[model samples]
Target: MNQFIPCGLVPRLAVTVVLVLVAARCGGGGPTTPPPPIPTLTIACPTAEPVQSTDNNPRVVTFGTAVATGGVGPLTTTCSAASGAEFPVGTTTVTCTAVDARGVSALCTFPVVVRPPPRLTGTRFLAFGDSITWGVDSPPIPAAAPSFAYPEQLQQRLAARYRLQTPQVINVGEPGEQAQDGGIRRFRSVLLQHRPDIVILMEGTNDLLSLEVGIERGIEALRDMIREAKGQNVRVLLSTIIPQRMNGFRVPNRNPFAVLVPPFNDRVRALAASENVPLVDMFQVFAADMSLLGIDDVHPTVRGFQVMADTFFEAIRANFEQQVAAGVGGLP
Candidate 1:
């Protein structure tokens, strides 16, 4: 409102107004500016209990909710899988990502393990292959019976370790049969007949040496056999064909196909990885000791069979024969 004012009073009022404005500008009057936000964005994933697989290999797994913390406003979070997701009988990883409006991102991962019900359920074992499985020790085509072969030895070893259960290894190794015509064709029938828990597959030596059957064909045939076994829920332990010295077939003629062993074994390794199966590198073992081979250069000596037994023993024990412990169950 307009009022009576002296010149001295007007100057003092202007000076007071100026001092207030100066105080406001010098951080002594109004609210102060806030510091920039510190970046502490974190994506936290919940610890989930492992789901046990049932009749199906893959089970439906439900996990706790994942969240993001300590980020700026308008933060967005995304997870790889929702709560109810189908997980296979192994480890499955779930990742969560949190992104702020400023494009700052934080990531975290947690594993969802789905365990199967005792991979080794039964004690029946099937040793399936060609002449090597038939056990043609020295020469004369076959040694009548595979009594002293790797299969028998493996059976003995398993029985020795597992005193409670009688581990029976049935030698179904047919001589001179190609993988396609012999292995893949009759694999399902054999599986049905034997009802084995594990199959020791060591075929394709005939295909390697045969002119009609190519080694690649043998590899495919082996793949088919592996799938057939898996379809029956039977575990498989694949083995590479043993090294063969030149001049096989008792003709003393140089075996031109002997050169194919290395490539064939390499393919076997890749096949093992692709199929996600356990592989026993018998080629590496036999190649190391040429003395272990028989006079015919194709079959293994008694010593070589013993070594094969030892190798297979370790594989079986490591994978299947674990004594039952807390969180680590094994066969009875």
Candidate 2:
């Protein structure tokens, strides 16, 4: 049978069908959703070896220039070792990871090789001096061992520089000992006992205070010591006595002993030149900076002792490196 429908009813049926389709589209669980794409993350470690200073201690390595590429969202590259971190001697594997805001990360590692400082030839050293050498009336110098004097400090410096060889630096410093007695009689005993390759001689500071041991006698004693060392075939390195600092408690820091420094140092200079001995001018070091001397006006402060070690090290190294390199007077 043919069914007859009105035009208004047909339009209403069409509108109802359209609404049902729209409801289906708005409903949950309509279609499977695709997973989010993986974020890009990659990092590059330092390729070239970074030039480091020639010091034996752990070095602070900087990698501010190491960059990461192809990362999504906010990206950051972090290292296991932070920048300015001290890396110890030898190879250290440093890992750098790049991460994005999406929690995606990629890492790269590099090897940093830190070699020990270069070595020197001579291993035996004898440091001969007076109370200043004994570290008298000064701030306690920092040291690993009980001895905080320059000879001990010098040993530490050498050990740090030359890890392969063992060095022995004997400190034979006598407190209140004058140059005439120590430099002549005791020096020969020490030289015979130690049989060192180098003798670091810094005396005559105490001699200036003695009325009997004037500059003339002091100079002769030093000359005798040099002659004694040469007779034994051991090298003698000389140093001028550092000037006594003025009393800071008193306005001028005026040391009554200060007036005598120049003439005495001049004589030492002349002696070194005449003897052709290697000289470390400690006088200039103190005169340039009086703070190196402590309040007692005779002994050096802790930092002064460090500078003392440094100067001695430089003098020894400069003088001996060539000879040792040529296999003249070298360590075993």
Candidate 3:
């Protein structure tokens, strides 16, 4: 079928159609252009509370999943301190970064605190004994010679291993202090003064030197000191007496008091075993190495002190590990 049209109407219709086509070709009469998509990034894992470090143990950081959407394909995600990596003690920033294929990145940071174990923070260790604990040997003098003593060195070692605040190691050793004096008179006062979390008892050397005091008396005094410290809720670490040098069936002239070492150390071992107190076997450490002793063969050299510190550190670390494993808090 054909429809008739006036010449004037056909010409107007054709002109209108041409105008519409021209407008469409010039892109002025089509749907509006779509806006660019918003880049999407979100942290799937919520912020987690700081976790405390276990005693003498390491802890690793764990992270949750992160998601990204609405960006270019092939998104990438990275995290600082990747999962299962050990974190140092204290607060650590675990950053999860989400990167889109368009090179756009969003960051999510959470605190992963590794709190120190109670043993490492605000804990005091008192080295209580005779001249040995006083740090008599090597360069520098007593009390001030902690740098050459086992206690201070142990503090440093522990700080390194645990990555926490170093504990205070107070040297309360007197040059000629006796164990009986410590057990009866000085124990309560010193403990009250320092309020130490632990006490390293290494007396009895002076007691044995007296000869008249006898090894049994020294042992009894040590036992008394241990009991007193334990009663006061202070952990005790008993150290065996170090060995002295002998020259051809004769005690060294400088160390005339060496006669009492063998029996005294034996009693010390027995006491520690019977009482179940932690023991640092210093006697065995120095027994084979005479060079570790000073010129007098009684006191230790600087190197010797370092070794002693290592031994004590190991024992203490082991004790802490055992306690933690057993789920026990404080002293056993």
Q: State every prediction's TM-score relative to the real structure.
A: 0.60, 0.60, 0.59
lDDT of 1 by residue, 1-332 (tens): 23434333344556666655555545567566899877699888987787654333567878887788777868898888878877666666788899987788999998877765433345899999987887768654357556788889888887766655678889998888888687888889999999999999998888876643577799899999999999999999999999888765567643666778878889889999999999999999999888878878878988888998899888887777644321322111
Stretches of model 1 off by over 4 angstroms after superposition:
1-121, 140-142, 211-213, 247-250, 326-332
Candidate 3 residues 1-332, lDDT tens each? Answer: 13444333344446666655555555558688799877675544346555566453556766556555556768788776666677666666667777777787777776666656645423578888877877788433334555677777877877666544556678887776777655446877998888988888887776766674667777888888788888888988899988877652334363456766877888899999999898888998998787888766678888888888888877777665322211212111
Question: What value of lDDT does candidate 3 attain over all alpha carbons?
Answer: 0.71
Look at candidate 2 and tell me the lDDT of residue 110: 76
- Which of the two candidates, 2 or 3, achieves a greater lDDT against the reference? 2
Alpha-carbon lDDT of model 1:
0.79
> In model 3, what is the error at residue 301, expressed in angstroms?
0.3
Which candidate model has the greater TM-score, 1 or 3? 1
Ranking by lDDT: 1, 2, 3
Per-residue alpha-carbon lDDT of candidate 2 for residues 1-332, written as tens digits (9 for 90 to 100): 12333333344545665545544545522577898875467787875354333554667766654577775768888877766677665667778888888778889887665544556667898888887776664644422323657888998988776666777788888877878866687888888998998899999877777543478788899999999999999998899998886555445554655677788899999999999998999999888988887766677877888889899888888876432111111111
Cα deviation of 194 in candidate 3 (Å)? 1.0
